[model samples]
Target: MRSAVVVPETPVKSLFAYPLLLSLLVGGPALAQTATRDPAQIQAGTYAVDPGHTQVGWRVSHFGFSHYSGGFSGVSGTLDLDPKNPAAAKLSIRIPVGSVSTTSAKLTGELKGEQWLDEAKYPEMTFVSTKVEPVGADKAKVTGDLTLHGVTKPVTLDVTLVGAGVNPLNKKVTVGFEATGVLKRSAYGVKTYVPLIGDDLQLTIDGAFERRD
Candidate 1:
């Protein structure tokens, strides 16, 4: 009789198998709606963007003119997903470009005019994260298309888990994350050549999402 042969598993197979096993153990129950407890809800909860607590700002040089700094106000959004399967997530953010403030009224108006934002035509900008990749325990990379001035472009953001806990009022477990990214102004069609403004505009986004009740 010939001896039975056992095939050796490859490292990639083992790595993928580990997640499957883990899902079978942890995610299985979390995913099983009828079999398990009610899946958590991600809407119907109070989520403050914490303008004083958060930041969505950008900087650009003026023809070597000078450094200009400004940030967004009235930030808002909703985060929906399975904490167990964070990749199954969705987010939305809206910003008013008209509200942008600069050190000078002249600069602010210039930024909002056709030479830059063209606020008359594109008054608002938005972003909705389409994909989320887990970096570690509470860190992730959020990838999505950002729309600005009638143009949409794919962008990647690095996110950090700020904190998560149960909200007393809403009675929902909430998770917080801070996401950041940067982009060139010209890429989004914001091209206003000036003696002072630099083409390389630095965009910084800090997003903190809360799980809904």
Candidate 2:
């Protein structure tokens, strides 16, 4: 008798599987929720952005059906804090557009093309705080120039101090903050599919910095 023929089943894969897997591999562990504490009495100085601990995420309405989201890595920046005078605080952040990741590879490729971010021409985007307004002991309104898609626009973000303390493992003073803002892509000349893809996008930044001096 002829040997029975058999076929192997193929595994199903989602478009976002790779992105999810990459996020998991890069993200070490889930952060524990700490009790709300007053902002640390941080010394007046400059702090270096901890790239590994920084995450810049964005979400946009897609055809009014869902809010699709993605994130960018490779962040490098500095924070000049003025505890005595919070308004004198300054922040300079740089993000490489090429580091943007999405759920789909095709979408990512398109975003890097001329129709969208045009990453080749504008490889990096920056935000330099123009003003800082302290609203509370642990919250502030940060206004800055956000440059993207070869265009620059004024944007404001609501920032809150998460926590600040000495890191047990790194043995360094670390500060954490979370910020949220909204921007219209069309204003920045990224009007690919305006209404359909969504013109307004929400941005959230969770960052950790180590004191340099």
- Candidate 1 is scored at a TM of 0.67
The C-alpha TM-scores of every prediction are 0.67, 0.82
Error of 2 at 61 (Å): 0.5
Candidate 1 lDDT, 28-120, residue by residue in tens: 644321111122333334454534344578887855757778876666666666666778767777888887886788978887899889989
Clashing pairs in 2: none
Residue 181 displacement in candidate 1 (angstroms): 1.3
Give me the runs in candidate 2 sitting further than 4 Å from their true place.
1-36
Badly placed stretches (over 4 Å) of model 1 are 1-54, 63-66, 166-175, 194-196
